[model samples]
Target chain A: MKMVRVIVSFLAMFFVNAVSAGVDDTVWKNELKTQFFADRSISETENIIAIEAPYRAEDAALVPIRITSKINQTNDKYIKKITLIVDKNPTPFAAEFNFTPLSGKADVAMRLRINSYSYVRAIAEMNDGQLIMAKKFVKASGGCSAPIGADLDAAMKRLGRMKFKLSGTAQSNEPNLAQLLISHPNITGMQMDQVTRFIRPAYYVEEVKVTFDGQPVLTAKTDIAISADPNFRFYFVPQSSGDLRAEVSDTDGNTFSQTYRVEP
Target chain B: MKCIWIVSLGLCLGLFAVQCQAKTKETLEVQKIAPGLYFHFGHHELPNRDNHGAIANIGFVVGKECVAVLDSGGNPQQGLLLKNTIEKITDVPICYVINSHVHPDHIFGNRSFKGRGVQFIGHKNLARAMQARGGFYLQRSEEQLGVKLAPKDIVLPDIEVTDSLTLDLGHRLLTVTAHGSAHTDNDLSVLDKNSQTLWLSDLLFVEHLPVIDGSLKGWLRELKALSALKVRRVVPGHGPVMGDWPAALKPQEDYLTMLLKEVRSMIRQGKFIEQAIAEVGQMATGRWALFDAFHKKNITLVFAELEWED
Candidate 1:
């Protein structure tokens, strides 16, 4: 009887692992790594950076993701760039964030379109070229292929409109949180027109630049994976009041810029 | 004598098999809400494998010439069953299958009604919406709803209602009006002028919670305009038919308005979407069924839209 019970428990454990293994197929190691970072080693560790995402995304089109860094930005040594990738999406390269020393912290929060149940990974590259990564498995599907916007007409009417909101009073030499909201549909081009039999062309924001007093804080190269009305929350160090400005450019060659005056 | 016994036994077995088949085939149940208006009240439950995605109100209106089907059932099987039920009630050939919106529960059954002379109708934006979501809906049908579907299952509307199109169902005239972005970007409501019955599919949620796939502000705007219409009874997509015209619109209006007010305030307070989802819309939890399933998602969508408000 004891032997039978032990064998039954072992079989149950094996089944559970097999089911979970199918979910986290680890396509990143074979495909994503070779395609993105060839010959360069990326350390898969949580010490340098940690990714926060809903285990089961509430909205596939707008899954909120936050990447926090363990080390603060310093002139001597700081993280230079962070790349976010969703493994199972048609285009897995979601966004690449280039951070400067003026960016007091490397933390970033944004919404993304996750196409399937896949791993969302954020890899941080230090100024010295060392890469460290963190990832979370998100259960979501059909975000890229879902209709562009619930209110596509409304989104089109206010295309390229941008806004900046500062969370609280800025302290000099310390990281202050700011949110940048841009109005764009970020169409994935995967949607098909049943009648016309024509595929909608992909139109999305390609570049975003944020500056604090003319000093670059965060610059991001985004793709269709970025959710509609792309909203980003990041930190910048304001040395005694400055003009915070954001310039956004999309695939259609439309450029929009907005500036908010900040006081420390 | 042996040959006679064998023939008698075979006849008896055949009769039993026919009886069993008849007993197992479930027929759709519908009620006559008005003079010529028939309504099938769907149970308030989430669409699952057990229910086969037939969790929405669907019915037909009979007139002198033909019959107009309001939103079809959730799956192709339900659509077939609805067709059978309509045939049992009246010999009027189904002239029009009017789709209320692009949601699967309302439009998935469109395939079963595809035939020559039977025109499928929807809002002007319905074609675009259907095209955009058709692939995704087909991919998820088997896994999510436990129903396997092919590309032929997604039927596009032959006639589009940009503003309002009136169909002569023989003696009765049904006016199909296309509204702005409310429940969805492509939402159509049919009004039977004879019986004064408005088939506002998914526009008014009676017991079930109202889902916001479109703009929150837009839905509230639509309710204001639709309330002024003179109607004796209304049929919702999820709940029972109501005799009160505008009075029946109160519960949904209140819930939506409250969500707008609360989420807007939270945005003004410099709160995040995460915080708003957790804190907003707590007062009306037990008032509506399926609040747990859709309330948080509603909050998330509302927060994203209202946060952009100036």
Candidate 2:
């Protein structure tokens, strides 16, 4: 009886230990360090780049991230590219933005999926071979698990219908802000179909481009971290009284475009 | 014999610990937001890697003979616990249950009060929203919380208030104000006159950032109106009880003010949406920490609404 009791105790202890070893916070931190330096280098100079986000997110998966640059305005040169990276995402590269002077302030905002509390870094490369960066930490979790508020079929039915709004007097000297609302599911592939228990495949907004009067304003390339029903906003220098056009294409080959007339 | 006894003791202790931990009834801390009103802080727990912390709040108003509950809880079981807590304190039956909005967290526990013949109240739009998405919400709750809520558990609101309505809780007079086209079209706020307490469900997220699925202008106006009210205390949908409602109002109001002003300014400057987002970066940084997640989204929504023609 003593021998049986001892064996049972030992087995129970072993099972508890086995379960505890699976989750490692250090592993997540280490993975972030590995990806932090993958393609971008940190810079110390103030490069007129800024990222605005909520200090704490109401929803982790749908936390809005925006990146903007002022370097081009001071130098009359355009930015080559901008990257939004989340240090801890399974795929850390949230989005990459490309721009031209016609792209205006090189700013863009989109909803993203955050697996946990993590730092978000926005890096912009100027045409003059300079990289400027800004970082903000957002507190939002369970974005990957949040249920789609709308029916899958209904959400899909309205996918890719874009709306553009250019507010303020078009004739004013102030810069015009144009917003684009895109209807897309942006499935991160990590979520399971609730009914099927099958892992959904990754599909997101891979790229977006905006044009002001036929002048390129901003371009974005993203990963699976984008939330469903992604909406984007940016600034552009409206030169003439022409239509501001937006052309967006997701990874799934879905393309959408909309044009709003600028007030003279 | 000694070794066997020691082994059995260890096993018994382990079983006891398991049972203790499995007891999920947590003692909730309640605070009086108004004279006759109380708000209970819902516990925050992340049970699984994929699940987010539950942040719903429960509110109740004590009257002469009965009490009214607003927004039961996140689950039926939780609602049962809340009911038990209420029963222990008072003999008054729960006379009314009002869902401030149709969000699952705010209304999922409707079933716990159904069999008791309580009068359930909500916006006229809630029944449709629930009927459309009730099954999906149930499935997700089960998947995420490991707790299953039956379809029959949800009780449709017998009283649908449109515009505004006042409820007389006998000793305490409570006013239910409906703010259409903010947060959600069916949003409502409960105000208790005797205690001068206002239960701003989801309208005011005290310490946490406010989520705006509604009109920024409308929400801002509602906040302004509430700020002008003579209430002594306010109970937010999420966060601790608020003694100074204005202190809790700043972050959200500041955010909306900054978004509308900055985005409008950039629009006037002829900057497109992308440029405005970049240029408006960190404009309201020092005010609130949660600005990062909501700032740009606010700008996007505000810009869309402002630019829309009548």
Candidate 3:
């Protein structure tokens, strides 16, 4: 009877230890909850906001993420803010994009960082008191340790030369997709300088504003999760022929702007 | 029973260790990039304390009286070995030697073909870069590989192409076009007309993560243009011969496009440099294993170039 009791206890202890050895789900959950509410409150509710990205990215530092909103039912409504939070990053809040009605649709396609295998959350707020959320888990790592290609001096030479590629012709009623390619290291603080052991100071794009024919269309405010050399692809309803302008500024007092002429 | 179990475990562990060691060693696989063009596929294995020579892919085009050699291997010894291999396949002598780019692994064996009267060719920019960095490259290579490489032994390109040039090997015509700034400021592609073979140097890397010291957009554009060519075979700078030119260009093009799109968005958002690096974390996934080593560096270069104003 004593031997049987000992075996039972041993088996029970083994099971308990195995469960404890697993990843701390509560830790990640707490991190997500804390980061989502760091600046604003959020509640998980169903709405038209959706985020598209691979569940497992091949490259961790430059994962493609797309956020789209199907809330076209109302004309006056606009997305006030869109936030992407990668739960496992040292700083979970990846990016926050602010938009105005000129933004045609509450849509954005950008790349972001993933520190590890973690869940990514996209929270969108409408003009009215409505919060819509979408979540996805991605498996990726080592984004913080990759090296920047150019030397510091070389990288700063031509910092903000923008190229805009309009996907569709102006005649086509289909919403034109504009792809803006920008140049910036968007260095995250977690990376160590190759020559120096000291961690690099955090430098990333803080805000992006896109204007169509001098009218405000889209604006974005982001954090460390924004990948280097930011690329923005979004759609805008082309009313007529005009110039599309984008002005971008980083935290380091560097401002770059470019204008592309749109034709009918 | 215990002894037998121990022996079985030992054998299993031995097999596992051997498999692990084998995996670590790179496999050099050669494939036909075009009908008659071929290139070896493998990363340059940096020599250890015992190994004396480095490895690189040497490409050639067979002709009636002679063959055209593109980029020699790491050392004179490697160069001789490659020359012998070429000689065995063709009875003609190697008449023209072209250095695809100015990296040492691709140019170090220039001395081996020195006395053979091989006409050396390269981009105008390569000669300048080589001249400027020849001494430094030799010194570092000798120190790293524990072998002496004199700058005098390095052969400069006797023939320099600025815009475009052609080499008519009688039976096969090879058009050499200098594409504007890719992989490096001076990148050249050798297109064989008869076989529709395109020796793309380091322009396209298959499976391996591409190293970009040049313009990301430019390289992508170059690849796109190359894909449109009548290329039936493609010999890359470091990998196996790509049978499918368009399919081969997709991975490289996709990678660059992804990098450009991602980095451009970050710059637009006003993400600082540090944040950009952090946020762009290992962004791509699958098939390509060394994506981590090359992606970040590519991002940095792309960011710098894209942000640069005229």
Candidate 4:
């Protein structure tokens, strides 16, 4: 009965196309604005970051969002965290990612669900406690409930298969692009398992840490907005051949870790 | 067949798996739809042990100085056959290799056209869709369908049509329009202006039941918009070629609309997907091929979306 109430309320969000249901868009923005910034002063500058998604989402359930930091500063004033928000989703908060000096440029790309044609905003939290935002309007609806492509059993069985691929030949001591894939449903509580006729409990990758030679490169704190079988693409300057490690922990407290050797 | 419903799940599941070898190449037969426009008709056989995942319609359009391939065959071997067939005809340089969407049966043969100096064209989302599912499809082609994919097998679109773009095949011209997610997120339809033929490429299913990979609402909207286009003929991706445009678009529209209304009603009644799967759209089962295998999936997908609708 409570689930019905939640779904109906979510549907109302769809019907009203209310920039902010029960609150104005600016109000919702300010609310999130407060959470990410806290007491820190906010300077809305276009200098540091750009958020990119297709003007029209090809697949609502798997809309790819790419965030790039124009500034390559390593520490101190460097970007400390990145957060994503879909103003119209049933659950508006998407994700927040953290970066370290080893992460050559604070550039990362991941996919998420866009429940409706809404403004998808990405905010970067600087170490100095300043927050800046970039926004893109994504035209998509009904992403959260899109049917899972894989069988429920198979999807559950292969919950943590990991694969890594180099974008190009890793030149000695050059910034190399790497792709990491984790097999996961990234289920939001709203989804119903067709097989069992029951709602699938929310289970998603909560944190992901990428390290090169045991030194932290990047740490991503994600949420249900992340797509199933999430993929992370980033850059790292490898000094020499070393083992690249990925440690992912989901909301279910399930930790999956794998190490892929960087080919010389 | 025993019933009209074809078991298309064979191709999706690769029902009979085998290790494919380079089979003896066969010559492709192309039917002349209009002057200089030809299409290769495929069998209704499921993509199984015998067919080698080659059950979709494919063809090429010839212009004055060049030619444009509409959709390639399913596997590398079938692509070779289609290529050999083109060679047997007039020798016009292939200016464009247009993929209808990211379906394996429609794209795997792209390997045969590698290095032919042909530009592969598709919807803007084709590359991403291929990136998301290419590896799985490549693996399944071998594991389930017995077709081994080569390095150049899966072709990503070089020319992405975000809105609408036209290709000049010599004196003749063909318009390619990118429609929002219909059968798939990357469904691209071609319109040959010289001849009044609209290549609906999975947009309009003639006899075969439609598969819903993208949005059901979007697909229905597409059909409504396509019904207004005054084309003399239609070339469907999986069914019989049609001689009429709007008239031929009825059954599919009715089918989709029926599912839409029924699914919405079921959701209002608080029916779960399992109950709606059996109860919704039972009246039209005999009118379509692969109704049993894909119909429920369509219902499942559509219900999942409409259930969230207010």
Candidate 5:
């Protein structure tokens, strides 16, 4: 009996070593659980939500990530809140977005600064108060420190200009997808001034509220982790032909708004 | 007829000389730019397998005790080649390897000098920057450029120069000055006291158009300070060795200044980035090489930066 037990233990040791030699299967998803879900019971389910990011980030600074709710829009199990987390960012919690029933659907896309190999999780809070999450393993590093796409004065001068495109032509009472481009510096306080040799103060857009014909769509509360000139894609139901407005406000208490006409 | 014949002969000789220089450039080696200073000029273009990542100006200052190498080439092979060239020049031990910035073309050659007991020097933020980018750069070297890189090829500096630090090569003390984000966030320039020659790595461009990867406002501000240097000659990162330096900076300055001034006006007029991308910098079209490929990125960067000013 002792000899049989010794053989089994040796075999188990060999198995552990062999498995460890390969990519150490503590997958990015598992890492996220430890990083964000200590002591909290978090539920992971498929098809409730799906998160999409590049398999490998080409430009670590500007990684595009999109999260879509798979639950039927007509169902009462709707997404009320979402928390964006990049596991390895210096500040791992990227942003949190809140929505109301007036929101057409919780399909949001934005750019993030992924500083390293991290599992980006989108935890959607349903109306029943259950949190469901979808994750993607993003193979990118060094997004937080990646230089903003431009110079100080130059990036600041073009601030507050917004452009948007509708994914599909508007139909009355149908939720349509919209992609918005907001030209804000989104400066994280970590960046240093190029000439002054001092840390540049943090200035970024804190809130973006989208409405179609004065009806609520989605209000996103963002942080510095959003890349410069923030981009967003969300769903909105157009009850009729009217103006879709994006009212953006920054940390400096500056508000910039732009309106786009959508035809039914 | 006699004058015409003389002119034709002179033109033939000039063309032949040009052809000869081009041929020699294929296996080119470093040349003496000043007393005790040697440099090799890289081609004016992007890095590729053919150039073998030698698209930046690399050189060394031979102090009496040892040699200080500035800006190793783009790959390990180029670094090895640079080492070989140094061996051929003199038998002195190499003391310091200075990286101009984090750009792959400049620091990839760092591994070739390993085991030589040399201290690698760079901007204070280099380790952080390299840590973030080293993996991707290593991967790209293999996939895109088709050049396989070992882990060691991505070298980080041990000696960080935050404000300014001077090192001795025995008799020569080279002052490595760290500048704020211009050209790149981790840019540093070296000054040789013995020769009074300022080596402005990528900070100044001569014939080729300056590429903007950092803050344009910051770059323009740095240019203003760099213009006051009273050096005898200047070594640019990707252009011919220049004599009239601060003056040589005018064309690049003009282009960047115009980009800022006009782009700001465009924004103030409520013209979007799409319009600025199409119309800005059209006047400087014929004056620069690879303008079409790199100009839009510059405009985009500048426009994005300018938008936040308000």
Candidate 6:
């Protein structure tokens, strides 16, 4: 009986180690919870939102992540905001996205720079002020490629260029997918200049506001973790023929705006 | 009789140790592709702990007055092996070490040739790329390549080639040309005037799947410029050297062109990147080695670039 007990304990320990192989989840768990929602309880379940990410990213510089809401965006009960977090990144807080009733759906997709293998979490704050969370483990890519933008020159040459891609035509009072493309080299300040031997300062998009017919749809505050040439896909509902406008600003105080007509 | 037998055994052991040392110091194997031009072909495999990143074609050109090392090696030790090979072949001193591009596999061996009177040459943008990527490369070399690299391993070029530069190695003259963004932002190709041999490093891959770390459109455009060149034979960064001038470039061109076309059409269909990555390259498999390793990343990069097209 003693020998069997020892074997069982050994197997239990091995399983525990295997489960917690990557960076400690508790670091981000405690730190982010304390920082983002101090004195407030957070529900650690996929009841409100769920995040989708590759189990192993092929490119560390551009890992695609999407967040889907289980409930619809209604005035009475809706997801008001969602905060994305990477546990092992230099900055655990990646971005915070805010939505209004004008947003037909709370689904969003974007690319991020993951520095190391860690848990990616999305915390949703509902209209009732309840905070719900979803998390996924991701293994960061390892190779010759660095977690930085490729073709910085091309991104710089077309800086502040913006375009709107709408899926099919807009429908009245229903969810329609729209993508916004912005050209900006989100320099993370980690790279050193060979000749100058100096670290470049971090310059990235600080704010993004999207509106339809002057009604607010989505607003996001992001940091350097956002990939260069930021591309965002979201859903917005148009009542009739109107205009969709996107206004973006960076840390350097540069603001760019573009407007596209939506014919229902 | 017993004492003599013991003595002979010790002698035999000493000889074995000496033989081991000599074997370790054996020079890297190289083939003389042309008169005064030597080439070393690297195997098509991903950089791993077993290889230590020594997976790029590296060689040298011997001239009357001096020798020019085209690329060093994948690591400091590989660089040392290459230096030993050069010493065994000729007595001329090495004058210039020309780097092809910024990939770690191509430039990591630079530390082996760091000495006075041996000037390093590269594209004008090479230093900037090295500076931007050197720290990250140094940090991850240990975990990825199983070799810990210091800041010294990331050497910058002393001389930059903006448009074109010519170096005289006595009877041999090498014309170094800097290309626009193709394989990478900084790509330099060397042409030997006397032999008409062009060393088109990663810019042309004969067998290995060509990696696209730069613009897909830019690479297609650079292919046009490279195909128009007139040369007796060309050296690729990977695979065998070919005497067929522009004809040797067809495989890489076709691969890049197919990728561009599929990605553009996917964008036209309003497909997302994930959908395109899954459905785009089904037909092009088994054509190139390391396709599974690098194709998805290539599709992702090309999709990101072409989606913004007007």
Query: For every candidate, what share of the true interface contacts is present?
Result: 0.44, 0.03, 0.03, 0.00, 0.10, 0.43
Q: TM-score of chain B only, all predictions?
A: 0.94, 0.79, 0.82, 0.90, 0.88, 0.94
> Across residues B151-192, which tens digit of lDDT does each residue of candidate 2 receive?
665667888888778887787777888776566556889888
CAPRI tier for the interface of model 2: incorrect
Which residue segments of model 2 deviate by more than 4 Å? Answer: A1-264, B1-27, B32-35, B43-54, B131-136, B149-154, B245-248, B266-310
Order by DockQ, highest first: 1, 6, 5, 2, 3, 4
Docking class of 1: acceptable
In candidate 6, how many Å is residue A190 off? 0.4
Q: lDDT tens digits, residues A1-264, model 2? A: 769956865665465345332333453346553554454555746557888876665455466677766554434676678778876566888787777666556777776766555677787777887777788776543311242222233336577777775555665333566677777767655432332223346666787777776777777776777766666777777656787888888877878888887866
lDDT per residue for candidate 6 within A17-92, as digits (tens), equals: 4543544678765687788888787887766788998887767888889999887788998899999998878788
TM-score-wise, the better of 3 and 5 is 5
Error of 5 at B224 (Å): 0.7
TM per prediction: 0.92, 0.54, 0.50, 0.54, 0.61, 0.92
Per-candidate alpha-carbon RMSD to the true structure: 5.0, 10.8, 14.6, 22.6, 14.1, 5.2
Candidate that scores best on lDDT? 6
Model 3 per-residue lDDT tens digits across residues A150-213: 2232334446767786664664333567878776767665432221223447786787878888
- Which digits, one per residue and each the tens of the lDDT, describe model 1 over residues A1-264? 769966865665466446433567467878889889887998987778999987876667788899999989999889999999999887899999999999999999998888767889998999999999899998763211253467788887889999999887778889999999999988777764544456678889999999998999999999989989999999999988889999999999999999999888
Tens-place lDDT digits, model 1, residues B193-235: 9999889999889999998888889999999999999989889
- Point to the candidate with the largest DockQ: 1
lDDT of each: 0.86, 0.66, 0.67, 0.74, 0.75, 0.87
- Model 3: C-alpha RMSD to truth? 14.6
Better of 3 and 4 by DockQ: 3
TM-score quality measure for candidate 6: 0.92
Alpha carbon lDDT of residue A29, candidate 1?
A: 76
